[model samples]
Target: MSRAEANTNSPKRERIKRKKQQQGRKDHVEVCALIPVFLVSRARNLLYSHLMNSR
Candidate 1:
């Protein structure tokens, strides 16, 4: 309601927003890193299955 109250709330909101953005970026980076690992594992599994089936 008051300007002083709004000012105090703004800083806290900004901090929360910044923290959320940082967390989202961190998660995105982790997911990006994991994607290659996941793909590699999936490829290995597929290759193993193919080899076994061919034999």
Candidate 2:
């Protein structure tokens, strides 16, 4: 199982984990970066569809 593999690989994983900790929360930053663009595109599509339908 992957859990067993990770247990075996814990030393390497720990090193990588420490490196990520030093890198200042990259996962949160990436999600934050994506959300606004996703919302904006959806809003723009809905607005365009409404405008077309109103004509």
Compose the digit string of candidate 1's lDDT tens values, residues 6-51: 9899999999999999999999999999999999999999999999
Q: Report the lDDT of model 2 for residue 8.
A: 86
Among all candidates shown, the one with the greatest lDDT? 1
Taking all chains together, each candidate's TM-score versus the true structure is 0.78, 0.60
Per-residue error for 4 in candidate 2, Å, reads: 28
Kindly report which residue pairs in candidate 1 clash with one another: none
Q: What is each predicted model's overall lDDT from 0 to 1?
A: 0.99, 0.92
Judge candidate 2 at residue 6 and give its lDDT: 80
Superposition TM-score, candidate 1 onto the true structure = 0.78
Worst 10 residues of 2 by lDDT: 22-31
Clashes of each: 0, 0
